[model samples]
Target: MYSPEFRREAVAALKTSTLAEVAANTGASPSSLRRWVGRSDLADRPRSGRPPIQDTADQVVEALVATAGARISGKDYSTRALAEATGLSQSIVSRSVRGLTVPLTDVGGGRELSLVAAGFPLLILGARTEDAGGEDGGGGPAVPPRRIQRRIAGIAAALRSAGVGRWAQRFDSEHRQVPTDNLLELIAAGGSDRFLVFDPLGEVPVEVVAESDSRVEVHRDFAEFLEALKDLLAGCQDIPGSLLDLLSARVRNGLEGVLWRDSVGVDASRSSMSSDSMEISSWLPKETRSITEHLAIALREEIIDSAYEPGDRINPRLLSRRMRVPRASVDAALRRMVDDKLLDGSRGGARIPLITTGDVLDLYAARMAIGEVVLRSLSLRPQRYLVPVQLALRQVEASAPTRSGIDVEDADLHYQQELARASGLRESARVFEAVTLRLRLFISVLQLDYSPASDRIVSDDRAMFAALSRGDAKTAIEVWRGKVDNAVRHMAGLLGRRRFDQELWTQLTRSLA
Candidate 1:
């Protein structure tokens, strides 16, 4: 029906009617009746029925399926069996598993993951009180425990200041709250090389159709504990706590954006901003098994949350400004992004060649087949460039009387100079883009204020220029890369947000072909 009132009424009536009653009244198949109850796309006869469930709990169910994947092995668990294991409704299990795209089985209402066949690890985050939800009195389905909102709020704030990970909350059918936690883990051994966090609560999460070594799971308790900590996250309203919320959101957003920028290509930017809070260095996590692990989870969620949306650039300089951490640290984090295959770039080695003869032949053939347009554009450039170069030379002479080129004066010449400067400008832009990315990563690691990262980057640049002038591309790149890598290592050393710049970058660029 066109009117909301009509839809509401029809839905109300459909929900109350028995399955047989709907079939008798509609004279349609039971399948059609079921579809009609939920379908709103239909116009006049718009199939209406019970109100659609909020589906928020699907995240919790999906988390359960992931955790369960780690716990079970070999043969895939039946949907019924998975339902029995994670205490989720078969429908929720099915939906979330499908939604999250994590490896899972959907039998009737339950979902299962075939970790063994896929060679994927079963991930298990830390547990909380709710993952072990109370049994339903009717015994038909088990509900996740209610999350302690106030407590979670407190923890999220503490995490903000303490430089620990984030803890998010969700409610179940029984109004019980559950937590979703993400922790970073580094694996370079097998399968896909990825470093972006995939909290459904955040931005992006990869789906595990069959399974492979690319995924890792934390202790179920960690995820559960994060749920319990939700009250702490939810209740805060001031200072460190209030800022913590924003930081938590930013942390999630920034990381995910960096992770996916490449796939989305040069068309997107990601960012998150938190209000001023106390400096976090001294308060950094001190425990070996601290709640810090959840930071990765929070970041993952924010990344997933930001999927498809443009966000702040992950430039280390800006992030250093925004995060108040050292720019050097930010650079390091960007390197990690490179390592994880989430993002990629190059100063000198971009097209240097990264394949064996056979592979090179294949790569070249493929490029030749599809890159004709770009090739033509490049070939036609020199011809187009001569006039611009001559004009630019004249400008340089006008600007600095006796200079051959490099003029910043004389509009037209300056303009052509700027045009010719495009390559360098583009390079710098790309580098800064890469820098901003690393900055976010560094911020997560140092958990310091934002400015320091920028300051540190400027400091590192002093040596950077010197290194570049020496004609030592590798050394210059190394020195520049080293400072950033150090920041990443520092960030990873914190607890769970391990460094992966080297690996990620290699993987991402390697596949540019």
Candidate 2:
């Protein structure tokens, strides 16, 4: 039988892979994998008394606390406002608030809810008394057992009033079961704006706030956390420039502690652990991508940056030594990239594929056909589907004037990928991504040796954006067709300069026509 930890690792792998893939990697049957996922709760056990609390109830209580904090800070406390702040539905918030037994008075005949004066002290005390518990006696700081009990009572009362009494009881009891470091990593990777960890007393001893550039500010004190919350609320309503300025100020304040040691430092620290042990331990955190996946991405970047030329063989042993990962992992990554057509695996090993003029034309033709379908679907969808597309276009525009051709190419590729994703065509998006992988090799070669011109890329993309925005699918397709034809001609010219066969090039061009 697999251990709980083994099952947990398998479930984690399922997040970024298919069930069959996980089963093949783990040597487990598909049925067993499904069962493990179904029963993957870390705290799986039978409760003796009352029914178990649902995750939705937990979400509601957390939202209520955030709402309460905002209300006390003089922000808008209406259901709609609370929903926006907590990323919950307005109907859920309204239903939860109505169910709560807390003494709340209705403003505008129940259109808005306000906690009674006595309730405020309980929430404030609950927030303040929530200590990290290990601080006393060189651990950090200590609170009296009686004070802890009082804090628990107050928070439990609030939760009980909200019909989550069972959850309140489980709060203190289950705190130790949580893997703190793993939870922090997961929160850092999640999309939530705010996350709070209560320490039995309903006091938030750990709070994580998402910041720009994929960073998170972790606040450890209730007062300090409340101040950060105010900033978050203010930043949300402010203009983009002002919001970035405020974020920069906050980042500067915490820069010292935020800097982490590089992989070399981590490697140095892992000397005591066996390599097998380290590999197993790394798989425990769901937020941490698999080693093979990381290696694949790193190798992909190397290829896209033209570190390897066409027909150059990839040495897994040398890469393993250079990257400080197991050779097996490097081999697996090479195999994955080969499967994606980013590398050719013939001649008994993986190597960069030599590009042919016909190959370029074929890739562009496939991309054009897929792009037409995606663009048409996108035009038919609601306007909100274009948000990511717009952001990607902005990146392309911003990088156009930069001296780095690599930057411009990267942005343009991302814009196309985003366009595919926003189209809501999953299969088309997947195929488009595979086609783009081969296209990246050509683009890299052009950027490195040929210095292919890209003057029209930004203008063409902008025009397509405008067409898609106006729901003009015909114009968008025409613009895309023009862009593809331009790319084919440019690549053909580059190949001609390199002395490819004239007869083959002519035949390929005819097929395109």
Candidate 3:
């Protein structure tokens, strides 16, 4: 079925254009077009049906048969005994019992079980969750209750932010299970406006499946499942949330320009501004700045965002054409950034700065010292500085660190840059931004030699944000120091160097102080 927006667009088009034209524009069949026009509304609604229930008996029977087939020390279950254990009628249990893929002997009146004396694929669901609070640290299921609760809370927050909080409350997350064939049957029967979560029991490498409108989306884990849910709710008219709503206002507001630029790549020069690109550009902050200032800000954002990786050449000619500006303006911006130490122009051209083991140690020492001073300053004037830090935190929270190469790193640096800009110590903040840029570029270069844990970077930022929000300067600085120390340690190992020059490190630390 066509979405409400598509139907409305078609109706509006029909007022000025022919039905055939509308059909062509919408990719809707002529019959579908007529029906859409005939309908007063195209909103998705739940189909009339009874609430779906699982075939507990069938599943219970399957479990019993599998268990009995194992023949653990010659123990077995009769049909009547199985019915009692499973709370099903004996007749139902009898009918539910089926031949297993693995052969077992029916020894006790064709009821006793024996394992097949043949080689066969035996599926084992041996996956384990985090140990629970028991003597043996035994958990009933692989998915721990605390983990499930956290996921549910996260979903609630996403739904609430998406303006579907009322609908979200109706879901009993504690009752969440993997959708089985029986559950899918009922859901398909019930039709639109149905949402379900299912996790199969004892399946190693468990998958979460979401089915709707004869379509199934399978996710490998809870995180991916949440991402799928976000997509679903964002697209559903019934949810009252757009894709933009899934992201923070700051991200949604700024992302279009960034995304468009990324998509166009080197060929941005050849293409005219698309309608979508124009719309995105229009949403950008309309500052009355010169082309040079704009170019510098854009480049700085890309650098801070890690869009420009270490060793990536900043081709002035390509940039000038891509941004539709003068070469001199681009050149001027490059020179300004180079002067600010945000980019390196040492070899032949402006490029992302590279670093060595010595650079890493000195940068971390400076960053740690700068962070201490900045946190102290923020503690003195939390009211003045905390708001922007919180605002930047939202921007980072809205971004997905795991989905992209640059997004997580970019978001991490972007917020730190914001915090630095908000710091009362202007000189310290300036030095922090330069040092951060240098460190991130160095890490990017290090990635060419060894893989680094990007998630650690994101986690540190979150920890720092949490501390900063509480006006806990000491803890925030400690977290910040830990982040720097981690990067330095990793980079030092990659360089086969144990330590940086002690004299140079002392000088950099003194500068931050």
Candidate 4:
């Protein structure tokens, strides 16, 4: 067992004993932080199920301040005018949204986020080996092949619908038949350098919105963010992370219905396709009376979207800048909201806070436990994992030619998040939020000091897959158990052991079993 004292030592070295503050004081390079983030066992394993956003709220007094891009010019509450606006006896609007779950409900449309202008789409390119030439000439298709210009528009919509980020219409609104060769060109032109790329030898469209001038960026201290999140998870808070989940789930589910064509008939209106494509009523634009409120809401989601799973990690400041707002304004809003308890950001890695704190943890524990059970259940698919594991090893062999401006989340997370979805584990989508929460919280605390690689996740997921292929349920159990064990150890180093517990895991497993 890992000693809780490690977390104490890590904490002792900090200015405020918060992950963000300590990570800043440590002066470790971002690359080192990335590596340490994953090396809890020297292998990249995905972190999952953090607390929810409903735990804390961002309170910059939306009506008083207008969100940057929306451009609200109003006679509402500013820092000094809060008492008169809503008959509340406060002076600053910045101090208003605290501890309230329905922050936006109180402020009106002025405090909401928009669906546009949030991210650039990043699409993974691929070429089939058979297309290159037959057996004698055995090289996979060129880096990018010669094909028609096509953008993964459907994918873009799905991502946006999932609240991943806003889909950049410039390059992605419609699917253009793009050639395999112009891939990098497209990436440079419309693709954001800040993205979580998931290319497992296929044609996948994924992207990340980038943060500008990392140095000047200001954020909620990561350690405190994580600690607060952990505290909320321990039932020290009153709000619910699921409340925000309500927003995302409703939106994504609606989008998912549109994407999967779940809700429409074959001959639906030209403007209204099935739920699989464009049948997303929830995707419609909402009116914004208060730009600041909407801006804060968007930032909150952006922060969550920037979770550090493996390849996709981002800074909330990145979203703030992209939203065209001042960093101070964003932070002020976040501070006030958190001070009141609207967003719960306990995962302790990225700047985005997880809305659901405690349940997020329980969800993670439950999901992992279920994953373990699934691995054991699938003990006959060892061969199915061979190619993936081999490819992964080869990937590490290439030494990532040049590092990405944004680090990749553990491959294990990518695989498992999908598997969780495949298993039809009711919480597949919810788990995505949970995983992101931890990464966001972690990123907030570590910044440049955060280095996350998924060697352990690879080892475990592969081993379990292999075990399943081999029909060795026991081996799957062992491998998966190890994976969770390693993650717990790593997290314990960052968050106090007292912050984590067996109840969540035990309850999760009992249900899973």
Candidate 5:
């Protein structure tokens, strides 16, 4: 795990390097540090249950001694002025600055923040100030569009044998554009020397938005940016390895929601409908605000979305960049999720899990045995999980992808999560999630067409819900058992049809050892 000081150092390094490079050098993931940078809102989310009691009075006094640049300090600015800059409420500001450790010896028209005698070391860098007279947010000089185009062309030339495409000539956004048929067109037309106009805020045509295609990717910078473009293009042709890493990074930006809609088999119109309009308020818990909790959820969603597949190693450094938090926070979240059983591996490193047929069978048996007991008890207390189960059902239906493997997997996982929550067995919930993750990983790695199976999952979930409606615990348990059995057999059949990767199998054996 990374220490707080190290995390601060990594965040400070963001000044000189791109998030990707910083991650590569520091062993800190890009996403973590990104969050630590002015994106504090991501980390300040409220948690469920009791709030932690604060020694606010003491904190207010100590606030005076803390360095002004690093933290909110009386020496930096007045309470009202600081409140305006930080955009915090007056009451919060007042509570934080109400007391003083030392008497105010001077009276002046203006308040100046005082630094502590032994000022804190500069670990984390504060927010950046933009360049004067620069169009982009960065402080450096902007490279001309022609220079970027030529650089991309050179990279494309080098990667031609690897199925790299030409420089796309159009963009949806000003900085980047993902053309719908950019990959297919490049392959068909052969590589061409062309440059797309740079538009950071270009409006995508209606058709492009409607189709959710990835035709192009544009960026303002060269080098690393061009490398990302090359890998993304290569991914379109089904090449593996680093392309997966590229996808993992882009996944943080809603790549699945944007690019893979059709191939994944989603109900486009239904997806377009806002969740707010859906009747989820009755079942879905109020969303948690904690960044760690939120990151946990986001990571799970990305995993199910197949941003990183089985056998794909997670780069804590790169992941930190994607999640925009510190490596320490990412490590904490990973440990928590692993405890929850939604992820595999330990703090040494984490990966999306892989599974064998025996693992599938064992998972089913456990679910059947444990679920039976839970369902039987729920019959005596039907009120407990009933609402949550219904809520899960609603999410599955509302978010249903027409034939998407990930969507189906998500639905199944959501149902299981709700059931575990209802069972009032936190450990059980975690185990169930672990099982679900394994199954999802298997499907993603194989890229199996589980469309029909997805439909069946929803149907079975509804049957269970119907049984729950009548307080028929026995029927619900039976339905759940049948679903589990079916999943095991289905997975076993798929596994039989495909040969296992011997290398991955060996690695798994060693890891287990």
Candidate 6:
């Protein structure tokens, strides 16, 4: 069904264009368009039937049975195969199978679906039942235990191809009734690894099956079921030994994409598995940033939050132990901060630097010089970067109302950095990044409260963004230079109040002797 807004748009177009034109453009049939025209309301009329069942436990059981039946009959099972066998819609079958399988790239660089080991018990039971019902109740031809073992071996091979390990460890630890020595010996003899090691004679407990049934009953749709499964696996501790319970945990973590490669051994430029991995990567709670980078960011935050005072010495060894990171990584991060002028490392160890008025002026002067070049370059093609520049300015405006001075300072720094990046000059952007880092340290050390000046700060940023949007390089540079001068004046006043030495300040400010 079309949304109300979509119907409104179609009806609105009818006043200016013919019904055929509107229908062709909107992809709605002419008959539907006729029914929608001249209506007082554009909203859809309510339907009067019960909705179709998109997913249910019964549907899942049916699909599992079909898959098992097909496997025993020497036929490949797919969504279409299951639909034909069970006389259900393909959509229903697909939804049921989604929780039961994982897609992995085969050696030939094509995606192939493999049933997870968690579902193996259900398949075995289904196959046994199908055999028993066949051709006059003599249990027809029994499925060979060797064939079942081979299937288990295949599932293990599929998982291994995708770089997954320890998949069958839970099965072995929780479900095995045999002694550890015997299991180890079996493994050493190359008898099907942990994946195939299950007690075929063991029966699933009634309570366990009932629990799964009750849980599935609460999930009204496939999405709810999927979300519940994710939450279950995410917080799962003391998972049960039953195969159904194991299925819930394994289905969430066992799915891994196989890296695709060409016949000549070079990695493929793009593949189905790569695309799937990209989609799934966002949901996985894993850090992509390196430890050193994370440490640097954390240290910067600590400094801005006043965790360290001026002239306070930083010990990397103690920091590594406190943060629980490698000493070398902490040292690397400290060195990086020192190079950025955020920490002073001159006297045998890193310490927070005491900011003087002269130091503040020098920092602002460096920024002004870099800003002039960056702003001028960006003006050459201002329209190409207007969106991101405006976004950065908006962030400053958003942080202006917050009581946290650090938030406003960080946002302002980000705005400056965005302008530098928008210039398209890579080398200048890198240099400007270092200058901004020093500026961040300058503000933090002086404990500048940006809340009072946030309005003016945001106003100045909006003016700068507007000037850049109009390709007015001169106005943009002047605005940036004025901001630098204002900052220098504030710092000089602050230092004067702190009783800084006038003689040393004058000597340091002398450009030439």
The TM-score obtained by model 5 is: 0.42
Q: Whole-model lDDT, candidate 3? A: 0.47
Q: Write the per-residue lDDT of candidate 4 for residues 1-513, one digit (tens) a residue.
A: 223454344444543455565567665544554445444454334557874332221222331221211011111223234456445445223333332112222211111111111112323211111212222122321111110000011122223334333232234433333343344333344322221222222233233122222211111233222232222212211111112222222343322222111111222221111123211111112452133444433433333222122223233343344455666666666555444333444443223333233544543565466666455434444355445444443443232232321222322344554444333345544544345434434433322221244344445555666665567777767766666655543554444335555566565556544
* Residue runs of model 4 more than 4 Å from their true location after superposition: 1-363, 376-410, 421-458, 496-513
RMSD versus native structure for model 4: 27.4
RMSD of 2: 29.2
In candidate 5 the C-alpha lDDT for residue 80 amounts to 67
The global C-alpha lDDT for each of the candidates, from Candidate 1 onward, is: 0.31, 0.51, 0.47, 0.34, 0.45, 0.50
Residue-wise C-alpha lDDT for candidate 2, range 242-308, written one tens digit per residue = 1111222223122111111111111121111124323422312236456654554345434432134
Candidate 6 lDDT score relative to the true structure: 0.50
Off by over 4 Å in 2: 1-297, 304-307, 321-325, 446-455, 497-513
Q: What is the lDDT of residue 489 in candidate 1?
A: 44
| Residue 21's lDDT in candidate 4 | 58
Return the number of clashes found in candidate 4: 108
TM-score for each predicted model, relative to the true structure: 0.21, 0.41, 0.39, 0.30, 0.42, 0.40
The lDDT ranking, best first, is: 2, 6, 3, 5, 4, 1
Residues 1-513, model 3: lDDT tens digits? 557787778787888989889888879888877887788877776758763223556555554443221111111245577678878788776555422111122111101000000000010011112223432122221111222222222223322233321222333332233223433343334323233232223221223222244333433344444444543322211110111122222121211111112212211221122233332222122464455445544454333222244566675643553467777788888887788676788886688776666767766887788778887777667575677777667655655434443445555666776777677788998788657656655655554222145556657778887777777888888787677666566667765545545566556655543
Deviating ranges (above 4 Å) for candidate 3: 1-314, 341-354, 440-455, 492-513
Candidate 5, residues 377-425: lDDT per residue as tens digits?
A: 5566647557877877876775455675545566667676677668776
Model 1, runs deviating above 4 Å: 1-456, 465-478, 495-513
lDDT of 5: 0.45
TM-score of 2: 0.41
How far is 273's C-alpha from truth in model 1 (Å)?
Answer: 4.2
